[model samples]
Target chain A: MLRYLAKKLITLVALLFFVSITVFAVLFVLPGDPAQIILGINATPEALAALRADLGLDKSFWGQYREWVGNLLAGRSHHSIHYKMPVFDLIVDSLAVTGPMALMAMGFAVLISLPLGIYAARNQNRHGDVTVMFFTQLGLATPEFWFGILLILLLSVQLGWFSAGGFPGWAADPIGAFKALLLPAFALGVIRAAILTRLTRSSMLEVLREDYVRTARAKGLRERSVIYVHALRNALIPVLTIMGLQLGQLLAGAIIIENVYFLPGLGRLVFNAIGQRDLPVVRDIVLFMAAAVVVVNFVIDVAYAYVDPRIKIN
Target chain B: MNTPLLGIEELSVGFDTPEGKARAVDRVSFALERGETLGVVGESGCGKSVTALSILGLVPSPPGVIESGAIRFENSDLIGSPPEALRRIRGRDIAMIFQEPMTSLNPVLPIGRQVAEPLMVHRGLNRKEALDQAAQWLERVKIPDARRRMGDYPHHLSGGMRQRVMIAMAMVCRPKLLIADEPTTALDVTIQAQILALMVGLKQEMGMSLLLITHNLGVVAQMAARVVVMYAGQVVEEAVVSELFGRPFHPYTRGLLRSMPDPAGRPDGGSRRLSEIPGIVPAITEAIVGCKFAGRCPHAFGRCREQAPGLFDIAGGQRARCWLSRFPERRRTDA
Candidate 1:
């Protein structure tokens, strides 16, 4: 197992290197001048040159990439031309918001999907199955942003249950911060719950047919134990894989929902950075998202060994 | 005589398909007395396995259902009993093992936990106590280093060893009735003999009624005292193992005996072909008005096709579902 973790760690580092390179190169390849975008074209050549040197754009591509990577590895960050703050601090602050929100969304997704999926699988071809499938279909079809808006309309606009948008600082009020994220988190969770529910149901259906399930029943295990303990444990393997992917997706794709709810998150930071051509923030956030995905997948692969003893990692 | 430990009266198990409802076990009835091994033998698709599953109420539903029957275990009717009641009996009063040892065990679970589960579920033994007893049961089944192997998953064990684990799991609770459905069919020839011997030994040790289902007549001869020969979802004949093998009454039973391959060569030192019963068993979907095996019987005559034969009591505690058993003189006349 240690050997397997070491191997996965190597792969993760190699993968992140490529992601960093691509994030760095893609921005450079795009039609934009960070210096010009920051300073108007009317600025004097001296001013432009000063800003270019300050931002390190005056350096060669290789030199700039090396310096950027060196700074990242050292836990130091370049100044954001747009926000005028250290990119690392900005990202950490955004993370403080997006991290909890994304995790809560994920928790919501798993909570909703597991029970609904198991129910659908148990009552397959019955009214309960059909009803669960119908709701999941609707959830899958509806966009998260639209769902977020709908939640605002119902809870905020009409029912007076929650504020329309905007997040209070976590330090001032933790409960308020939680309530601020609830609607957006639920909106994001609904769509993923739909996908996960479908996956869980299909996976459960297949596991239910396994010979061991029959053996469990023959052992006089309660139907609940047979389905939940014996069958669901095996069914969760594929679901875990999808869940890891979805978590990464939630981190990267929360830009629209974050904007919709005005929750100062990583997604909003990246969006504003892209508009202002803040190279360091954009590059780092994209790399962070990629690294998150790669790392999550690595964790999932290790978890498979824990869940199934037959999978011996050499 | 006291009531049999297990009795199935007119059990009919069927499956619904796109084609129609196909009967797998058609009005199959049998009794298993205490400490007796009753072998239900038949060809593939002959419903022997279905009958075994029905005993524990483990038959897969939707596709499969008990069309009609009463499975009397002890004093209660298992058929139509509440699932909770059946569950209480399962793995406690009765237990079952299946054909594929490789697939019948949960791949994710440790074998010791799998074996110990019934005890925890039925006997309310805690994990440590159950594991201790399970280790002993594993040793009884001759698994090497039983306690050490408890942490190993099903894939770590060889097929024969897996079968041993399955036997350990089923026998752990010391059930009153044990149903083994083709338990050793997938093993090596040598492994098959060992498994059979282990099962017979364990049955004697536990003093439990054994319902052994298999298509192998040789296995039936070795493990069973009384045997029921099934053909096309119905019991064609049943008798003491010796009586069935020595003076089989039904033509189907005779065909089954003749089909057993002779290990010794022909006296002339030439290769000899093993005799096989002609024609395949009829598909259950096809409605048969007369005897289900009549089409495959070499002695099939006018009345055999026109009317079904009932399981008739023959002399010496044997039962034959053949008209000839009623009147031996009719054997001379062809249709």
Candidate 2:
């Protein structure tokens, strides 16, 4: 098991390395003059050159990469041109807003999807299944941004139930922050819940047809226990895969959602940085997101091993 | 006959398909004495498995409707029992071991948990106690290293081992009637023999009646005392095992017997040709004004094509559904 874990760790490191290099290369390939953007359109070429040197853009590509990787290893922070602060500090500040929202949204998604998905699978081909599936199809097709906008229009503008956009410090007033986050979280979570519901339904349907499920029934277990305990565990492997992938998407997707809500989050920070061509900030955040994805996936893999004894890491 | 552990009277199962209402089991009736082994032999889609499922009320009700039936177990009708009541009776009184052991045992759960599930549900035993009993049952089934192996998942076991685990699971509750549907079909010849022997031993030890559903005549000869031959959703022939093999009155039974490959009757010294049953079994969807096997039976006559023959007693404890058996003069000699 230790050897298997070591092997997985090595593979994870390799994957992170590949992801970092690819992201770095892609960001550089995009046609953008960060120095000119920083200096302003009316600024002279000498000012631009000075800014480029200062930003390490004047250095060789490999030299810059080596310096970036070395600085990351040494915990040397990058300055965010947009925020005029350390990239780390900006990320921490944004995370304070985005982290709880993402967590709460995922929690809501799971709470809504689990029972609905199980119900759809159990009452497969009935009115319940059809209705849930129809809504799920709509959810998967409609983008989160559009859904967010719709929620803002319907619940905030017309209904007067929530604030239009912006995060109130939840620390100062927990109830106010909760009320503020609820609509945005619900908007994002509904789409996720819809996707997860579909996945859970399909996976559970397949699992229910398996011989073990029949065996469970034959064992005189109540229908509920048979469906929930025996069937759900086996079905969860596929659902977990989709959920892990979506977690990465949630982080990336939060950018748009955060922007729409005008919430201060890593997503909005990244979006603002991209618009201003803050390459250092962009590079750092992209790398951080990549790392987050890898770590989340690793946790999911470990969780799978715990849930299914048949899944030996080796 | 010890009040007959299980009795089925006028049992009929029909399904509402896209075509129409198609009867799967048409007025099929049989009795199983306590500790008796009744082998139900049939071709694919011949309603053998459906009959077994019906006994435990496991058949899906909407598509599969019990048109008419009384499945009496321990002097109580199980036909219309509530789902909750059925749950109590299912693993406690009537247990079933399904085909495809690999898929039948939940791949996610440990074999011990699968086996002990019935005990936990019916007996209300906690996990530790249930697991202890499960390990004992595994040992009873001759699974090596039962204690250690209890933690192993279904996929960790071989096909035969998995089937044994399934059998152990079914028998753990000491059900009065154990239904094994093609239990050994997924196994190789050697493992098949071992599993059959193990089932026989377990049945004898527990004094449990067994309803063995299979397409193999050899299995009937080895394990069963009485045999029911099914063809096209009907019981074509039923007789004492020895009598059924000695004198198969139904054409389907005769065809099945003849089709068994005999190693001693090899044309080449080492290889034998399997006797083939010429025509395919008729589809259930086909309109049946006459006998279901009439289209395929070599001994089918004019009346056989026009009128369906009800099961009639041919001799003591032997019944056959065939026009030729009734009127020997009308039997075809061509084949």
DockQ of each: 0.85, 0.72
Question: What is the per-residue lDDT of model 2 for residues B159-227, given as tens digits with 9 covering 90 to 100?
Answer: 999998998899888999999999998899999999999999989998999999999888989999999
Model 2 alpha-carbon miss at residue B32, Å: 1.2
Interface RMSD list for the candidates: 0.7, 1.0
For residue B301, what is the lDDT in candidate 1?
69
Q: Could you give me the TM-score of model 2 versus the true structure?
A: 0.94
Question: B1-335 in candidate 1: lDDT tens per residue?
Answer: 89999989999999998889899999999999999999999999999999888888888898899989899999789997998999999998899989999999999999999999999999899999999999999999999999999999999999999999999999998999999999999999999999999998999989999999999999999989999999888998999999999988888888788788867867898866777888888888999877888787767667888888899999788988887776677664332
What is the interface root-mean-square deviation of candidate 1?
Answer: 0.7
lDDT by residue (A10-100, candidate 1, tens digit) is 9878988999888888987878888888888888889989988987889998999999999988988778888888888998889888988
**Pairs of residues at least 3 apart in sequence or in different chains that clash in candidate 1:** none
In terms of lDDT, the best-performing candidate is 1
In candidate 2 chain A, what residue range of length 10 has the lowest lDDT sum?
Answer: A244-253
